[model samples]
Target: MGWAEKRTGIAFAIALFAALAAPDAYAANGAYAVDAADISEVGSCKVESWMSVATNTDFSAVANPSCVVNPFTPIELSLNTNRARSDGEWSTTLSPKAKTNFVPTGIGRWGFSAYAGGSFDAATGENLSAFAVIPATYRLSETMRINLNGGWLWDRTVDRHYLTYGIGFDWKFTDTLQWTIEAFGQAGASDTPSVVQPRFQTGVRYRPNEIFSVDVIYGRNITGENANWITLGTTIRFPVEGAQPEHRRTGHL
Candidate 1:
């Protein structure tokens, strides 16, 4: 197996172990221990699956396929209930690792993770893949932390991999609010064999309560298409007890 495939296999094993052992390790229902310093007394996990059908599907005679051009209209909607799972966010760093404050020191806290999902395109069927991230956090002082994040995408169907890495800083201005600044590059290769572009993002997050939080993120690809996008998301996490809920999406440390 190639490096990407091997890494993915390892990540899958880790996820399976976590899912099976989560019940015993995290018995309480609504709280998570993020780090040694920050622990949530009540936490939960959330998994969100989204699907949208475009209104206008343009069929091309040359390509013999219908594709959605820019400004795709959306149709159909479904929202899940509530879930309590691990968050997927991480601090930035050179080392491709992930760890919450709760993870033990000796164990491999910072390493790899895997996910199984489907593609948005109708032609593509169900797909399962793995990804690796390197997250590092540096404490500037009592109220400031800097994070560096690098991400890699390993597609199982196409047998291709993409890479993006960036560095950012976070300032905990208050107990409940913080701001973030980040710049990342598309280090991964595309099938067309074109050079990847660099991207920049800025965002802020707010914690109204211990169990719930929200963030607004804006990003722009500077190299080629210069695509600019903004995202507003909220998260709720907690511990697991018995048979967990199927969906209700979903981050990290």
Candidate 2:
């Protein structure tokens, strides 16, 4: 196999080994626009897949399968593969990410996590970029929460770096349904702080059971290359035997 493929395989093997070695773990769901500050439960696994279509006729899809283990608390490791078709050409990319909740919930009524990862483009058959982000969430009420994310990304293709930020408001309407709205933006390396590109998105999530959920989202770019888009996604969790049942309290998967 190629080097990239081998790397992917090795990553998966390590994540699986960690998951299998852990004890007493469960699974959790995630959000669509903003990331949650929670990690998957120890010894559990989850898979998420989504497809997005834009007004410019570009289509893209991604699959992310992740596993969790607790050396202390819960830590997650995931692999992502993305495919896109634009202007009659297709390209694929792979990314492996690790996330952990550094500050547990109920501390100052807030939760915090750190995420880091790198992406590899199949067209180049090599590393493309890397990123690190801090995701934070605050509980507003029993049914409402707020999410914030900030990060820096190194764009290998351009040999430049960019800043990313997002804010999300999430409301749980019922036990099985929730709604979210978010505003996000990006600033390029050479762009002025005031010249950043911004986007707005709104989505709904439906959790039919403890182990499965789906989301639908609509968004529009208000800056550069403006386009409207829609996406649909689903997530499935595999809980380890004898693990305690966990419910969605923060709208995270």
RMSD of candidate 1 to the truth, in angstroms, is 15.9
Misplaced by over 4 Å in model 2 are: 1-31, 71-73, 190-195, 222-224, 248-253
Query: 122-236, model 1: which lDDT tens digit per residue?
Result: 2332332344444444555545545444555455546666664555555667767867776654455565332256545566777665455566655453222344444454554
Model 2 agreement with the true structure over 166-244: per-residue lDDT tens digits: 7778787888898988876566754433325676778899988778889888867522236777878888879666654
Model 2 lDDT on a 0 to 1 scale? 0.59
* Candidate with best lDDT: 2
Off by over 4 Å in 1: 1-124, 156-158, 191-195, 222-225, 239-253
**Model 2, residue 207: displacement in angstroms?**
0.7
Model 2 — which ten-residue stretch has the worst lDDT? 18-27
